[model samples]
Target chain A: MQRLIVWSLAGLILVPAAWAGGDKKNGNDKVFKIEGTLAKDDPADKLRKNPHKVHEYKMKAGANYVIDMITKNAQELDPYLRLEDSAGKNLAEDDDGGGFPNARIIFKAPKDDTYRIIATAFKGVGDYTLTVRVASEAQSILEQLKESLGTKQKELFKQFPAAKTEEARQKITDRFYELTADSLLPLSEFAQKYADDPAAKEAKNMVRNNLRQLEQSDSPGVGKVLRTLREKGPKEMHGQVSLALSQNLRSQYERSYQRKDKDAGKLLKEIEDLLKHVGENHADLASQVKDVQFTLKNLTVGRPAMEIEAEDLDTKTFKLSDYRGKVVVIDFWGHW
Target chain B: MYPHERSLVKRLENSPFALIGVNSDQDREKLKKTLEDEKITWRSFWNGPKGTGGPISAAWHVQSWPTIYVLDGDGVIRYRNVRGEAMDRAVDELLKELEAKKK
Candidate 1:
């Protein structure tokens, strides 16, 4: 049994590498194709019995790529795709994001590194044709913004620790906001033009989410800049900016509770006031705000670890509280 | 991370320390095979087939992968989100407190 298992696993690992090598050898290939069928004993099949396959590609930093996995027969197979960095951090995952029963992901590579594209079936296993296409214009613009914003953010953070006076810190904060708004203007314009493109939409959403998170900074100038962006910047992003501001306020309220800040009550009241302005169209954001409120009621540090009962590989039941006499470390993880 | 965790589990095997895992893998057979292949003797709780949305992770509100939590002997969460040497130091201190209490 042990020998059989080792041989089977070795074959599984080697076959993909051999296929990838064959693709590279076929001249300068712009699009690479992977053809595979998931079987009952295949690793992908074992991962939920849906057949999951992993392909690796050497991707350049700042390059935008669209990955598509379409099954030959839509009636028999539905494809799911996930892109992960070298460290197994998931960049994106999609099911039915393309034409029905197919998968598509538009991603801008964060760094020049090897990335894994994981293809799987939602139900039954079948053959899939996976292709990677480069989007040149999108890639070029994304790369520029990524480089400039990264440098500016790094320079600002470096100065933040050394600034001794409130005025000096405020100046730094204002510059950081100015850099953000200036850099985001072009991308926002691109998104406005290419409203239907997933890559553009995703890029726009990322900037909005990041700006929302930045609203948590203690610098007073940060809020002023955010208000300026909302009032005077692109009209298309106004609703998004308002929602982000609400999220930022919600985050601040949560932090106050965690830090036992004296202004926790005031922050909570502010969050309530901000929520009123968050339009009804943002049901998702409203639900998230409620979730945060729920989290505030529970899940505080120093509280007793929540009681849990789960089965081990041996199918034996165990309770978390059963190990009360021993110090415990709980690791939440997935093999994939 | 797994290698360091394995060694830590072995080092504290005979002590009043337990390393419980809440695994989010969907397949039981694969997990069993991985455990045997990796020579992992520590017991791990199977979170369920839904991966991240598994009952345990959902109940605990785990926002990220490999979220580690350290609990004192009394089951109160003392430290969290610490890994590597920081995790080692925190666990060592907690064990000493447990030992001192026993005395």
Candidate 2:
């Protein structure tokens, strides 16, 4: 069974690489195409430092467009796609949105104007096919939502790399959540309505991810959304949604309990019942269920910090318990 | 962050406060140079060759860089992921509490 699992996992990893060579359809709406090559030693501009090709296209206001830059023949080339208005204001930029290393941008044109589409290789030299098309009318709702959410996501991705401090990164992230706070209901509705659409899977993921972040930041919308999802979300989502809702409650209970709120006990009961329900009904998420339970019982605030004994920079032993009577800060830090 | 941390370490030099690190630099030798150049005086546990995926961070279930857990004098965790001024306040409060107990 273990060997079978390993092979299957390997197959899953290889699938996207295989698709790199295969022709991909940009949904069913064709508008225009540009084929270009980016070579090393090409002039670097203020907009993009990488070797790139630029094309200009006129876009209509309120129209949704799907832009894909897929590398041809060269698997080593990782394409980065960007869309900017004529004045060089960045509208949307993407890396790896078109599967493994390709780039896709779902953009909703804000005005009727000439837009510049810049195609560049993030790594290697390659010939790439850039396809621009209308986001099909049949999938208009999902496309519209994606374009709206994608803009903020693109901005975050663009700024995140240059963020020097944790505070700056948190500011960008908090802005994203603030911008998309109202998206949970609309996205959840989309996921439920289009249960079988490939994009629906993404929608569900966005909801889950946003919920997890909301829980962490203790956002006000978290409780309302969790309760709504638990009470009325799609049946297939019940298992995971219940788990998310329980986690939301657990965090709230932790806070209120810390403050000695009278409602803390009642909230704890609700959390326990929801967790038990998830465990009993969601066999597929068994491990995740156990993780939530473990965190609740062991890793919560006021619990004794877990002990650590390890080698320091010089291979000498270092232990957390050694500084027993001192207030300590364990910083899990890294530099890349 | 390093400059801020340097000042923080200096300020808390005489207090019962220790800021420990689990360093996730892939190259230990390079990190040794950085420690000296950056003037990092605190001791740091090596996170091994796997860097961010090393044993210590993996065991702590840390998903992001610079995950922080502030523990009180008795080694009970009191705060998490607090940074900058918030981290300073947490450490000060705990230190003050410890001093009161000593009296």
Which has the greatest DockQ? 2
lDDT score for residue A51 of model 2: 82
User: Would you list the C-alpha lDDT of every candidate in the order shown?
Assistant: 0.73, 0.79
lDDT of 1 at B25: 87
Residue ranges of candidate 1 with Cα displaced over 4 Å: A1-206, A212-284, A299-304, B14-16, B61-63, B73-79, B93-103
Interface RMSD, model 1, angstroms = 1.7
Scoring only the A-chain of each prediction against the true A-chain gives TM-scores of 0.42, 0.70
| Tens digit per residue, CA lDDT, model 2, B1-103 | 7887888899999999999999999898888778888899988899999998899887787888888888889988778788898899989988998999999
Q: Which 10 consecutive residues of model 1 chain B have the lowest summed lDDT?
A: B77-86
lDDT of 1: 0.73
What is the iRMSD in Å for candidate 2? Answer: 1.0
Clashing pairs in 1: A44-A51, A44-A52
Please write out the lDDT profile of model 1 over residues A263-293, one tens digit for every residue. Answer: 9789666655655555355565676556544
Give the runs in model 2 whose Cα sits over 4 Å from its true position. Answer: A1-61, A67-95, A103-105, A109-133, A146-181, A196-202, A246-254, A257-272, A313-318, A334-336, B26-39
